[model samples]
Target chain A: EAGVTQSPRYAVLQEGQAVSFWCDPISGHDTLYWYQQPRDQGPQLLVYFRDEAVIDNSQLPSDRFSAVRPKGTNSTLKIQSAKQGDTATYLCASSFPGLGGHTNTGQLYFGEGSKLTVL
Target chain B: AQSVTQPDARVTVSEGASLQLRCKYSSSVTPYLFWYVQYPRQGLQLLLKYYSGDPVVQGVNGFEAEFSKSNSSFHLRKASVHWSDSAVYFCAVSIDNNRIFFGDGTQLVVKP
Candidate 1:
């Protein structure tokens, strides 16, 4: 089975520029997430969606970052007026909710991630 | 709110030596724990997970994690280190299935 897919693998941009990252999750997966991983750090959740409804996005930067999953299968994360601090890897992950018993410890599948550099 | 802590920023060990990476969590109830590894330029992969049942859970590549509810910890260990095992390891916790909180990560270096 194919895993989560994301693109472009890398992106370089200047300050104030805008960029978008896309993600295609595994088939039948109901939960999709976007995370930002700074160098030498673990991924920080930006937003997540269950089906077409957003479950949580409190950590997301409302001014510059936005995400949407229109069809509940594919998602896009867009950054407006990117800054140098935005330089990090954007990771996309998916999971089957409530698959692992009551605790729902199901594994998450991630994509290769898009490395963004804002100069 | 649930959170994960990986105190070590980096660790180095000779090949064939034993390895252990520490993780601690803060939660009100019994939490779901996971260990994930990220190789260079690759996505994070599941090493193992612990929800219930046995405290010790085995994962791929000889990696194992022991979950302690009393101590609020889920530490990863391996009997012997391999050069290929060098990667960043993250500990994550979740009270519910919707959100997961990850640690700062620990980078492991296995010397030849």
Candidate 2:
């Protein structure tokens, strides 16, 4: 099976510029996620969707970051007015909805990630 | 609220040596725990996971993790390390059917 796919593996932008990253999850996966991984840090959850409905985005930087999964298969995460601190790898992941409606217990499949650098 | 912690920032060991990476988590209830490995310029790959029963869980590439409820710990281990096994490892936690919380990560360097 093909794994999750992400476009623009590497991106470089200047401060105050904006960029959008795209993700195509594995077929039939109902849960799609976006994470930010700063250098030397683990992936931090930014947002997630379940069949086009956002499940959680409390950790997302609302002022500068936004994500959407319109068709529930592909997703886009956009960061507006990027800052130097926004330089980090943006990772996308997907998981089949857990059995018995337990979404918290499933294993996740991840993409190679899009590295964003804001200078 | 859920969070994970990996105390070791980096660890170095000779090839064929045994390996252990520590992880701790904070959660109100029983949370699902997972270990993932990320090689250079690659995405995180699941090494193993523990939900319940049998504190020790086996994973891909001869990796395993033992869950300790008392200490709120889930540490990854390998019987023998290979140079190819060198990578950054993360411990993650999740609760209430929500998003996963990740650790700061631990970088492992295996010397040949």
Candidate 3:
């Protein structure tokens, strides 16, 4: 079975530039998530979607960060006017929902991640 | 709100030595716990998880974690450490399966 896939494993940009990271989640997975992982830190959830509907995006920076999953299969996270602080690894993950409104094992499959460096 | 804490930033252990990584969580109700390992330049991989029943759960690569409700802790352990086991370990908590909270992670270095 194919795991989650991410594009542009690495990106380097200058301040004020914009960039986008794409993700292709596993087949049949209903939950897709985007996370930002600063160096030496764990991943912080930026946004998530379940079947094309955003479930939560409170942590997302409304001014600069945006995400969308149009078809419920693929997702894209964009950063407008990127700053040096935006330098981090963007991780994408997916998981299948369990029955009865609860999670089954709660295992998340992740991609290699897109590492961004804003100079 | 649910949160996870990994107090140890880094730990070093000799090869073949027993290893233990500590994790603590804060939640109002019972939480689904998980331990993930991330090798250099790789994404996080599930090591093990605990949902209900049985305080101890076995994971891949000879790893196991014991969940303690009284102490609100879940610690990863291995009987013998291998050099390949060197990686960043993250403890996570899932309240509703929609979102998961992860710790800062504990970097483990196994010396041969």
Please tell me which predicted candidate would have the highest DockQ against the true structure.
2
Per-candidate TM-scores read 0.95, 0.97, 0.97
Could you give candidate 2's per-residue lDDT for residues B18-68 as a string of tens digits?
999999999999899999899887778889988889999999999999999
Q: Which regions of candidate 1 are displaced past 4 Å?
A: A99-105
Candidate 2 residue-wise lDDT, A73-107, digit = tens: 99999999999999999999998866676573558
Give the DockQ-based CAPRI class for model 3: medium
How high is the DockQ of candidate 2? 0.74
- lDDT per residue for candidate 1 within B1-112, as digits (tens), equals 8899999999999999999999999998988899999998788999998889999999999999998888999999999999999999999988885688899999999999
Compared to the true structure, candidate 3 yields what TM-score? Answer: 0.97
RMSD of each: 1.6, 1.1, 1.2
Order of candidate numbers by DockQ, starting with the best = 2, 3, 1
Show model 3 residue runs off by greater than 4 Å.
A100-105
Span of 10 residues, lowest total lDDT, candidate 1 chain B: B93-102
